[model samples]
Target: MSRMDHRNNRRKTWISRVSQYVDSSAGRISLTIALISIIGLYLYGREIRNKIAGVPTPSVVFRDKKRRRVLIIGGGYAGLLLAKALHHKLRDAPVHIEVLEARDKFYHNVASCRAVTEPGFGKQLWIPYDRFPVFVRRNCQVTDVHTNYVVTATNEEIPFDYLVLATGSINSIPSKFPITTASSQAVATLGRIQRSVAEAQHILIIGGGAAGCEIAGDIVDRYPSKRITIVEALATLLPGRAVTDEMRKVVTEKLARRAVEIVTGARVLLEDEEFELSGAGFPEPRRRVLFTDSGMALDSDLQIVCSGNLHYNGHCLQKLAHTHPTILDEHTHEVCVRKTLQLYDPMLPHIFAIGDVANCITSKTIVACEIQAKVAVQNLLVLLNAEFESGVGRDDLPARLKALVQVEPLQEFGVPGPLLFITLGRSDGAAQLPFLGVLGGWFMRRLKSQDGMTASWWRQLGYDNVLSNT
Candidate 1:
């Protein structure tokens, strides 16, 4: 029991530490390889499927310099993916893709909840459209959409060979920035909101969905002293295909451990443009009270509405109302698409819709939007080929739309399986995969929330560095 014994123990501890490090490194390596393999197979299979479905490859360059104008309304995930795919897949092809977005930059809506709380991370979430190679007409709001043309707010008539409506959904202020907002302005808004939240002693978040839960987690983690509460309209938090019971339980426990209050089956009532909070015991000024339909009154110093976006069917539906009233879903208030992801009306084959605007029977998510963009792009390429082969112009192609002829219909967005992820904070989260029912905190954090994938998204959108652009 001397120096020799101590040296031996130290040597054994060092070996054990080395072994653990090696094991963790090996696991990470394996995960990386598996992910790469999955991505490779997905891209390869997609290319093969596109070829089988009569979509021209990148090598197929159209000789006719008479470029086809592809106009995309909305620069959300779906729209950006579609534009990027078109540019990459249809390289040197006779197609000119353009996006008309009201905003000057693409917003990272997924990370917005945390971004709002932590204003330092807000600017990282917005990417300027100019950073990408695709043509983006920022600050351009489409007043009306027609079969082959769109009228802008400025009374400009823009014609297109093909049209894509990826306008996405409209939500409240914090969830979605103002339509015509610039990146700097959006970041300033987040900063102001963050300051307000920091000053408030108690915070009430209405909605236990992803946004609400995320807001609670981020706020609680950053400001542990603040009292936080989340109220949801449904019986359980994040109901339906959003999250499983186990995931919900973990998140619920996480919030409970932080002493955050959660109220279910609560509906906020609006009176004179303000939440009806008078009947609550708490007096105004000192404490802000919120009245809910469930007879539950909550008091807080500050309130954040983490609710759904407003219906955005007004832009394109006005034109579709007369021609195809049945294209709109009664319950979802989303545009109904055929199996090909095209507008249900046979007359508008050149017109396509993706993302939240389309009723794909899946929870409105980025994963679904990406899949929809791929299908829509593939179909559009096929239609373009048909047009080129027939020597028909854009106007004539609609009448001979292949989907209408039943020769080759567009592929559906394909109902998305359960794929959900909810971050409790920066370091912890819960997720549900396709085959994997639910995943733990470490996995979810590493997969999504670590850097919020802002850099990854920048690379995906053809940018090398996000901070450089900022």
Candidate 2:
């Protein structure tokens, strides 16, 4: 072989060996980095999830002999829907559900303004909770709640693995609870209100929110000749943070057509003190005097306060608020919750809060309550099932424990545009569904006002065969 050919061959051999060595080293380094990246990412993801989940609570451990208890306080719309959903989700699971409600029946308070105005509709408003699938403890007022138990007013200690708080807001007069849940007793209380309205020549409603607007509509519809006035402290009727001038004008015009008067930017005095009722712009011949903070005076035979939602900040709730300020609103005392509907405190994963009592959502209507109930129940079911599976010697802790689902936040309602259903009376009303814009005509009355949703609610509560008027 020639010297040139031999040299060329020798050079090609050196280049081939260099290329092979470099390729092998690069492959090993790339493989090592990929593995490290995957492991680090997994660990980081777990840390984030753990942080979101708060503290790992072993409070829900299940003993083979004992049935797990899921205690719910307050039998309002939120509580009822949660109980029903949980029951269905864990029908075969070994768990006991209990509802502690002060009243024996579920009073549809949304229709309350209409119920008190019309005596006949009172019966349809309150229905017994006896038929509920779970155990219903009547007259059971929860005075305190702790990590794993709740204390009743009678000093009864009810143990629970998981606790849900749905105690709704307490309203003022006219929107107040009935004296009793018994049909007869409720009828008597409602009768007195009806009789009072019948005797009164003039009525004044304080607070121009939904309650005030509804009550005004009901009274004016029943007694067209009676003088009715709405005294709102804010500048507009239906004074929500997001309420628009157009929405306010719509409600104001409807009520005005019914000859109901509205006084805005005036604060009504809640004291027993009386005024001359003939001062300033008010007319003379006062039957009864009413005074305001704005120096406005009016005459009315009956006055109903429909302002403010009083929180039942019991000693236990207050204690919780003090310890976990992040989970409780300082001003409202309503429990702060995550989008998952679980209590915002990372340490209290087993405890959940919903409905008007939970300040996470903007709207406090039944629509919002139902949405919260579903989200809370699904996540809770996953939690409880994880605990159950773990107790049964499941090795996959991560997989089982990650069952907690998330809930998307709801769009804000009752505001800048239209997202509320306000009935003027049996014949006239307005409604606004998401994406549907504003709705009117007889459809609104037929949906809610005509029967006050008595039938729809009864059926939803598992009374399929029950009569509508019952």
Candidate 3:
């Protein structure tokens, strides 16, 4: 072999070694960087998810705008829906809406009826308002009404441009036991109610509305040992509800089978520790001396007065009503102009009202409120188009679903609650429907029929976001 060939071979060997070293080194560096980037990305994503999911997004963002401001009072189904709608619609818009609620959490009154009657159901009713972004103010009951300003129980004044009065209606009886506070006392009281059913030998449920009837059914469902009686002043149970005849028969029979007694047209008057009833036989509202209309007045270990849902005055509602319901009255039965939801005065044009505080009415559902909030956010951006000739417009506006809402004389869901799921110790379930019509279910025997509440407001508060298992 020649010297030239040998030299070439030696050079080739050196180049091959260098290439192998470079390739391995590059592979290690690249793998290390990739692993680090993956770890960093995972951590960042986790933190973002936790914060974003802590509560529904605050308000909204607008386009072609500096910033939009909104204020909502109450975190009810209606109020929360409004906030969510605004965020979804105006994410790109310059909108910032704030919800002012009296409590730190949102308690759904709908589910309370069943929870109180049935065991292991109350905790599902409360969802803290802090889970969402609206600035939550707890223990601040609204007081004193005025134009553009809201005075709270604490005397601190909050100013707004547009006002909403989503405070809704105030009911008396159970309203006194609002689950919103989640006070230890309340939990204890609820426990006591359950215990009363377990220990008491006899129960007297006054009134025949959903509460009175359901309480009887639910008690029977829980403790069949208790003798339950329902005293209704009305001619029939669920006078104007939408229930079917078959359902009514089934309910009545079930209660009768359980030896449950019901007496219609019985007016109870309390004189001392005893209750007297006035019936039809005697001309002057004949009073029962010791026995009841059903001829069985035993000492009751528990007496539940589930008769009326009263309308106590609300300061925020009064002020909002004095200021803007008049404006909304003219725009009645339709969605309020988007910017009109701004916490500003409608007459002034820059101010708006949202949630229940505003007079924008259409069957006060959370979905409706959410839609109004979204529209308000989009419109705020449109109004904000001062620098440019063209204003911001809706790209993907949320479609408003027609909700079933009736407010003539302010009747709440006049339909009879589900009988199979009735809460009244069951001899007293009532159902009234439009066409299918006129029914009642007596679950006085089962007591544990339907544990699911129909209108749980906690869902609107986004409780399902975290408590999926519940």
Candidate 4:
């Protein structure tokens, strides 16, 4: 044997010994322990980072013999997040937080446009409430809200020490599902809409707001050869205080690039028009002519109404109008809330109104809901920990409630500012940031268009395993 052969033999012996050790039981146990230690360290580091960033973490909750009930109406984003935050903060306190939602599943309406336009996408958007960390009672409709209790549709009165009204608004289909819509029905509705869009050659979308633009964009993206028209009563595409002129121009241009026709300063006459074909033997939809106020005759096979005919879900508070006239806005029918997100009525200091239901001076968006939820949680905590005299009137208890925090309109702390991202299609979209100004298709695609942030939401609600299976 030469020197080189000897060196090779020594190297092979070392490899064989290491391989044999790795295959042994003791080595396997050591590897498992090392893996678990690494995972434990990673989780610990993540917890510390979350704490420093002001993110709430779930803790082991201890139940007291007598627990105070906290009832939340509408288990949408606002109500669900509020329940989670309260559960985290009051883990050791004798408090039971419950959310009452009419729908069986939590609908991610942010991606609703794509859900309607694309097949098999709706399933990911409809998340089951069973996986939610806090207690959420589904299919429970709140018929009325009283001072200390709420009346359910089933005629059961649920008493609560504190109540949160988060019943959001009801928009047109695809933008929002009906309050009574179950998970199966909602999925079927989205499938029907997808079929309708697929069959129609000329599709007309009423209202040039976010919903209309997104629907048109998604439809045209799926069916490029189809003619899609958007009609708005306003002069511009996106009309709101949050939308800048630059943002409007970019959205308009993006839609136009997709060959989506925009008809502004005109209203589609919806009354007394044969808008669709539905009778037997007419399996295929036929084109119908729709006249606008500006005498523009548009022919379309499908017409989607995304106009401002939204019904605010604050009517449940009408029962309290006899006592609190200003509880619900007479014009908008939105719940009138104070700056602290508490009910405007002094008699109902323990009741709060947040999200789209509350008449906050900001655009109704998820970001707004999140900011409002944080404020409501802070104020709720202050009230929960405060010492109140048994017979003290709410009006006289202002001194004790002085620590209640007020919401900063449109300002989510740690976030730059109000952010708006609109996806045109799978590959194209637009957005308006605080300091970044308006971004084009590339940025929007990477940010929201790919999976519509569905995975992030599932992960946020502690359903990461669902994503893996999907």
Candidate 5:
């Protein structure tokens, strides 16, 4: 009786399992089809966009016998990078290249903010113009880049055929590498910034973007005892951006923990000897402080303006974005290049714009700049070879909007890519990988950023190993 009962129970169990599998078959099949459709649509959409974008037909034959004359202007990350890509691509060919860079070295702009905290890296950040091949402009500045030659402030006319304008953004810091020239004047500027930071007790940093936030963190960490306050013009510290809530929380928490006060949703009115903000996130008025439409003074002992990059004066150097329609749009204010990244202008057939100099940017971090550099190089190679390619190049948005914007993403070097991994004092910090909602203390800062900060460009410039040995 027991054996018969056990056999009957086992048969019932097998029947139940078969019914469950049968019921789920349709759902699984539907899920698989949906996945395939999404991928196919993405690829098809990219192809359609490329065709609509209309890439330039290459003039230089990829395997041609003649040498390609490529002229790169301004040797920051953009110029140095393009030079490297050209080197690798034209390794076997006789490529006549000329890179026009003012000053002797490429200043590490990202690390410049870091210098406010750790004083040691300041001098090391500048690598001489001799680092890269072609023409070196030691103690020089670009006056003009006409159709045939590059004119310098010193009136030196260097001739070229193809042009790449990668002159990065200009910073106000003196010794920090000025946009033009290498002289005693730049030295005075560096001396002044250090003196200002050294003398101040209450520091006010305006604009909580990457520069402001990192600068605030660096300052507060370095001068722990100082009264450090950050006034963010936006409603939020890292507002509207896709940074992880945890990264924002961690950064806010870290700032609060260090007694660093953050005032969000305010506008800066004056950079008087004393720092001032309008309707600054503060509600009340303080005695002995002026109040405007915005709010009372943040009472800054020292004020550093991270008020975004100055673009108007940028043209005083080389006329880059002027002729290239791909750099910027005349009507909609968009990047006019295809995913292949060729400018809308028929003139700049194979060249591209990237890094801080890139227009229509939402994220201006070095991470985004690096991604642009890599893609610009890859796409440039394709252009040189008479083929078309596509890329996703959106900054600071969700994948849904990212798909809506639907540009190939440039590579980011930082860990998590949202919560900036930076060292405060002795490299103790929290980084928010907003994309992953992941947060960790000091791992990203010390490892990915601080220690991993190898100047890979040194090899490209043919300097680090060779220069060190000499």
Candidate 6:
């Protein structure tokens, strides 16, 4: 036979054998399973690569020169939700949404406590901003905010037709990641903290608030034999929170069951230098002494302070304070906004603030931030649509002011009442709901403690591929 004819006959014989195998139900099922496994692996590998190298930002397309710009200053929970909501609401409209965040990745502060105790878990806590629906300009720290524009640390001026400040706040390490923290840096920081937690025989956690309680819970869950002490200035645990006495009791009992020590009505009296050095990390001898205002001295191998030393990220609005004196609260130092979430300035109605930076009478939790974001998005759309209907140019200040609609505030929007969820560890937690009152560990675990709600957050932010593994 000719070489070509011989090759063709060989191919036909192989095909006939494959057809014989495929004729069986088991062969078809096996082939389908193999195909599915191959596709699943490809998708998972793609997600891992994206997580490592980071996803590239989509190119901005300004189809119209008259397109309005909506600038959101923080990439926290509120800013990201607002950006996504605005993008979806204005998908067909002539508007552009942009988020300017100092950090390269969105740090999931809710999961920070767990990440500090559990190694390798930090990788899921810092998600890249590129996964969001809107454009995010990471590592852009705003220095000043004017009537029409904002100045970044690099002195680059970015003008927006409407501005939303959601810079959130800064907390101590492990509870909150620092500004400009990249994903790798955040993971490394968590790893270091985990090592410190694992090595320490006795851990001292100041402040018996939710953070301190959760930290102790996480540490105890990881190292059941380690000695953990929580010191609080308040008389009871979870002071200053909107939680009920029952909720506090539940949390306290859970921690007590874990053999965690609690000291209340006493404040740690450490100097700034000493407090910093203590919290920095494990030092030589790995032994430190802390004194409280009650003349009590406590010794521990490691210290973690959750004393609620939070500072709002509204310093960029300082320049505007000269003109709009009420732009920031005199005491809280947070941005002062009207019920409509707008900067309480008639001349600057186009500027709005939300999240922890806004002087809202709500808990500084992710739920409050998301609710405020929705309200801000609604009001912003009202103004945007009104301007479009009024046939006024974007630069026409007087006409734009006249075109503005009477926006509704958060109260008028039927905002959900205050809800508090405190997770002790992966399987234990407590929550104070609106009508449900206070709940125990089962509800808390199902609601938040199981996975820190990280999976839900990833899915909410448009990352289903990451959700599969999470």
TM-score against native, each model: 0.85, 0.75, 0.56, 0.79, 0.67, 0.81
Weakest 10 consecutive residues of candidate 6 by summed lDDT: 56-65
Worst 10-residue lDDT window for candidate 3 reads 399-408
> What's the lDDT for all of these models?
0.75, 0.69, 0.48, 0.75, 0.53, 0.78
Predicted structure 2, TM vs. truth: 0.75
Which of the numbered candidates is closest to the native, going by highest lDDT?
Answer: 6
Give the lowest summed-lDDT range of ten residues in model 4: 275-284
| Candidate 3 residue spans exceeding 4 A from truth | 1-66, 117-120, 133-135, 172-182, 240-258, 270-299, 317-450, 454-459, 464-470
Give candidate 5 regions above 4 Å deviation: 1-65, 118-120, 133-135, 146-149, 155-157, 171-177, 181-188, 240-242, 271-293, 312-338, 360-362, 387-422, 432-435, 448-470
Models, CA RMSD each = 6.7, 19.3, 20.2, 12.0, 12.8, 15.2
State the lDDT at 140 in candidate 5. Answer: 59
| Candidate 3 lDDT over residue span 14-55, tens digit each | 899766754685754554455446434432443356467893
How does candidate 3 score on lDDT? 0.48
TM-score, prediction 1? 0.85
As a whole number from 0 to 100, the lDDT of residue 177 in candidate 4 is 71
User: Rank order by TM-score, top first?
Assistant: 1, 6, 4, 2, 5, 3
lDDT of 4 by residue, 305-374 (tens): 7875366889899989779997898776799987777888766677898888888778787777877877
Model 1 misplaced regions, further than 4 Å: 1-25, 28-65, 272-286, 329-333, 394-406
- In TM-score terms, candidate 4 sits at 0.79
Give lDDT tens digits, candidate 1, residues 1-470: 99999999999999998668646967656664665465445434666665789964624333354778899998888899889988887777667889998887788878877775775778878887766778899989987877678999899999987888888876655677657667787787677777788788889888888888888988888888889988888887886665678878878888989999888887876453443322211112235676899677787788777776556544556765567786776554688788788888877777888998987777888887888888898788777766666554444555546533453655555676667778877887777765556766667667786766677888876688876667
Weakest 10 consecutive residues of candidate 1 by summed lDDT? 276-285
Residue-wise lDDT of candidate 2 within 1-470, one digit each (tens)? 99999999999999997667546857545544554464344324443565688934223445454567788888878899889878876777677888888787787778778875787666677777767787778888887777667888899988877789988876654465632345557655666767777778888887889888888988888889999999999888887754455567778888998899898999988565332221111112236676899778877777766775655332356656667667777776688776776778756766888888887636667766776776677667667656665553233323322422221232122212235677777777766544444556344665677766777778766687444335
